[model samples]
Target: MTDDAVPDLRASDADRERVAEILRDALAEGRLDMAEFEERLDATYQARTYGELAPITRDLPAGNGVAVPPVSLHKEPAPTEGWAGRIVGGEGSSTGAVAVMSGFQRKGRWTVPRKFTCFAFWGGGEIDLREADFADREVEINCIAIMGGMEVIVPPGVEVVVRGVGIMGGFDHREEGVPGDPGAPRVVVTGFAFWGGVGVERKETWAQRQRLKEERQRLKEERRREKLEREAGRRELDGSRHDLLGDLHGRHDPHRERRRGDTA
Candidate 1:
């Protein structure tokens, strides 16, 4: 990719860092060899800006390397005990989160509210989310979403990663880790109508946030305990040193010999 393509895609310094992250994931997943990774990464670095990144993605080949599938969205309920209960919303609006994986080869737009998390996938292709619009809210796309073609947009302060075929891009939102068995599905090209959009509102339970906070607190408490233990050990050592000095002084004192002579 050269600096002369896609003149409108303005990316910041942080965006450049994300590009590196995408490349690293691709290399780790065996999508790209060391040499290719370095070459493309250098190209990206030299591009000067996001506008320069467009060409590299424009002429990329198919099978964008990784696999993305639209499996049923699942939610892991927050635990009933402690902090877990707080972040997990009440029973009324408790759906965990939404993930959309596709193999689309055409233009599509899904206007999302600022509160929800969105993930899009494409294969053998260059997909563009550079125009993805959002309000004043944070969104996270796990790095695995972009496998084939690459283009992602976000409001200022929103994060994004792009991975072309043989390159990996995106972020990981799940605290536990990437979910499920990794298997590539047969290539299926399915098309659909653009009508009423699919709406999903995932409410984070109070319990969930509570649990996260508690976990953090627990870590902090553990550190505190370790510090206290170390201090106690130091105090014990100091006391032992004092006792030893007192014993030595008593043994060396000439007053003890005078007392012994008087007793005799």
Candidate 2:
């Protein structure tokens, strides 16, 4: 979307926090008085749309910069994670996870089903899909947290929708409306949170990062070895040239035959 389209878009908690940070900076710098800061802080939390948040810090520098963001909201660039390749159609490796006064984790190289469910009671669970294959392009993850918490982690490029109810708790919708890659999977998070929270985050996989690191190291080592070999080859060529020049000038002399013929 264009810059003009941003104002009408729904604002995430991150947007609100950005504005709040600017207001706090203004207060610390004496640009705003205590009363003004208090009023603006309250309004910042109540803001729901980008348009509503635009005016809060209209006169102040954003994130303590002359050139700031969200003061002029821009559409974030989407990353390509080769979502089409990850969408392997078949049965999921596993379906669900449960935690009762304990914790559970669903991560690593697994397949996510179309409708996977999880529950937590006085406990917590983690559903990490960074390295997961998908049973379908669109999948649903249902979570039920009671007096506990559940965290769902998805890689970037995936679209997320949170339709869960939270009473005295919350379901994180920060990653919503961020847009997905063309062939990326759409994950719908639904269910109930009673005195608990379900948090959704977009993060790069540790496995991917580690693999990249190792590849870089391998390339570096390969280059170093090639450089050493080239230097050694050059030294050997120089030594052979020196030996040939010494033989021509010293030990194997053609002048000795000429001298013998003159004597005869």
Candidate 3:
């Protein structure tokens, strides 16, 4: 005789539709994960009375149910002070000028280097752009790196877009060459980053232009072996004849031994 004085049973509509069928059987046995089943189905539609719907109807599932807890997502690295633009859903957003390098700590694993310059346009989550570095001029990154590694230095035309897979065990956008001035300002790296390592040098293709033409033919054969050992010490200080067949057989064998002893 202590259940709220056990004397007032006035719930209608078939007992509020049997407590909304036990919160839809605790959201179909999964026990709710769709954002807590939409916040307990919007608090059971803004419950007005009945002690505010009796603790979401006694946390439902008194019988057949129980199971739901698996939501892991981690890919951090987006915060600057001077000029980091457009990092959606998570935070940090700038428009025009920026140049920041905020404070982040991590010594055990070693982390601290976001000296400003990040620009992400559209992403659902998960992004770690390998400490992010986009020299800055204009940018638009997408999806974000689930593991990390993203670097973009825009200036030419200033347009870049990486769609997926920026997972980095190492490298991304690490650029250096591209400044011989061909009417600069025109760069655009697009999508599907399913891995890492992409250094853009005028839109490299043909196997990265045959591996940069075999690394510029091995640096022009090491500058032609240092210009033939500095031209063999400037051709031994101009004695000039460095055995070109012993100076052409020492002047043609003394004119062929005086014409073979005057034709004998």
Candidate 4:
């Protein structure tokens, strides 16, 4: 009979571990992504009955000598994977942006041209290229900060080159020198900052960081709950063992039998 046939039966730690192993194997074979694997893993540990655990691996093949489907090894990598999808070469979304006394911001699904010129005079500006597409493989950003500062944000895996000259201010060279991933775009920041500064930074998109943070928190909380449950189970088992031993000793006591004979 299958586990589902006895769905109401209590599940042991062994049963849960078996299901967890299946999930892990599925993840190793690329059948499950990280998010799905972690979700199923959490469910496996939280399961208290056979019913709860069965659904976690309902579609997966049973492990332990069972023949699994053959994994394909000759599949070509998807063009949409990694940097290939990100480098969309075309005309830039916008040519130039200038901030006089207020501020200018360029972010969110915009395209960067080969030479993007931005000037900030007495007002700060921010250029975020984290989620932006590129018009070319190698593009240049010209920053002119006369009396206001400018900040340029690029995503990880991008190659940054800072060649801007700042008479009284300076351009940030911290993000430079790192080799970019294959097919990834290269960004060059060049221009002058007379009395203002230009800063470059590498950061992931906000949504990506938030998703990762939530996943970590979920895993942490699950671990804490599992720990508490284990401790409680151990205490219960110890108490049961102690009570059983006491009953056995009372039954086998010679003094109790002798007292019964005296009464007779």
Candidate 5:
């Protein structure tokens, strides 16, 4: 049958398996969270026709086309490059920021010093490290805020240690202790806040996240091809065995008839 004619046909076990693989890839790439993945996975197995299976992964990258590919659950995540390039080990491009009654931001492709300090009084400041290089393996950021606020943003796969003290104020340390990438710098956040707040957040760069999604899709396609090859091999082996057995029976039957006739 033509490829275009198969959608209305009853979905086989293989069809359901393909859809399930696409869902698995989506979940791994963070396109879908656990709860959404579970719901779609259940629906995929319950689907009875190609039309039903097609919609399960229709919106996902893996299922953008008509075909749904298989993905290896055991595959390891792709590694980000070593941190040597990110650690310049020199003077910081900009040492710190101060906002007495305004706002200051230190971001972009700047160098972060080994010991960086920032203070905000009746104002606010922002420190972003998503694309910044580190001056040392271990960097300390000291922040002092009195009746003002500050925010620190770090990317995924970086160690963060928050040791800020807040008196009648708030210091965020929710992302502490998360494992970091190999050779990535360790960030120590130390600060004091009085009637003010300091917030720490973790985020991934948009480009990095997109690369991960594409990698997952590629792996899924490879696994699907492997599965199809395996199934084809099994079918060919079964056909050969059947033919061998039939040939043996045909040769024995003629001899048995001759023996019976001679005895009679």
Candidate 6:
């Protein structure tokens, strides 16, 4: 049977559970409010067929509540074009950085390999990928921070998955679970931390910020020009009306004079 036909069939507990997961993702992504989520969750459990379940999340970003395909562990990285062009499989420009008592940084125009490792002991390190190319579609950044800190900054549209553990320290995964753009590389962050922290943050590059600023300025100028044009049109319309009324009055004045003369 075709995939669409499956929806007509009865939905099992696993199907409901899958829909629930999608709902959870939607909620986390701020797609649904608490009231809508509770309503949908109740409907999901009571759903008997895929058809009934599909409409609950049909308008969501997850696409009709269908389960997401699991990320394959053994799948080979495939070469692609467009945004994926940034993912050129090869050796990384730099493999790793170590800071014992100071700091290290990897930023700008570098190549991130399939696996890049870093260590920090009583120091800090920064890995910025705003202007970097990926050596593979899937790359892992292994961080080991001991009584120190490490920060990984990525540009918008890149997928980030954080699976690191912290003991008496923390892994800042505020950017985790956010969906990435199509054809963008996926970043997997994993490692350990002891008495230190590793942070993963997503930010717009300088160029991107500049572009947004220019776009806003352009839009503002356009709106201003439009308002000016509308005001000019209104003034022209009022002037025309005034001229037409004056001409009518002038024509009637001669007739009024003739009428008065006849009366005299």
My TM-score estimates for the predictions, one after another, are: 0.26, 0.51, 0.18, 0.64, 0.54, 0.56
- For model 4, how does the per-residue alpha-carbon lDDT over 1-264 read when each residue is reduced to its tens digit? 442346544455557667777876776566887789878876665554556677788887776543222222344223224567767888899888999998999998899998899999999899999889888889999999999999999986688999999898999999898666556789999999998999999886676566546755765676578679989999999999999999999999999999999999
Candidate 6 local lDDT, 94-119, one digit each (tens): 89999999999999889999999999
TM-score, structure 3 vs. true:
0.18
Off by over 4 Å in 3: 1-203, 209-215, 240-264
Error of 6 at 178 (Å): 4.9
TM-score of 5: 0.54
Which number leads on TM-score? 4
- Compare candidates 2 and 3 on TM-score and give the better one: 2
Clashes of 4: 0
| Rank by TM-score (best first) | 4, 6, 5, 2, 1, 3
Measured over all alpha carbons after superposition, the RMSD of each candidate to the real structure, in angstroms, is 21.0, 16.8, 31.9, 13.6, 19.0, 12.1
List model 1 lDDT by residue over 143-176, tens digit each: 2233333223221222332211122232222222
Q: lDDT tens string, model 2, 195-263?
A: 999999987668545644564466457557867998999999999999999878765577877887799
For candidate 2, give the lDDT of residue 1: 59
Task: Work out candidate 5's RMSD over C-alphas.
Answer: 19.0
- The collision pairs in model 4 are none
RMSD of 1: 21.0
> Per-model C-alpha lDDT, please?
0.37, 0.80, 0.37, 0.78, 0.79, 0.79
Global fold similarity of model 1 (TM-score): 0.26
Best of the two (2, 6) by lDDT:
2
**Model 5 scores what on Cα lDDT?**
0.79
Using TM-score as the yardstick, the better of models 1 and 4 is 4
Give the lDDT of residue 92 in candidate 4: 93
**True lDDT of residue 147, candidate 1:** 36
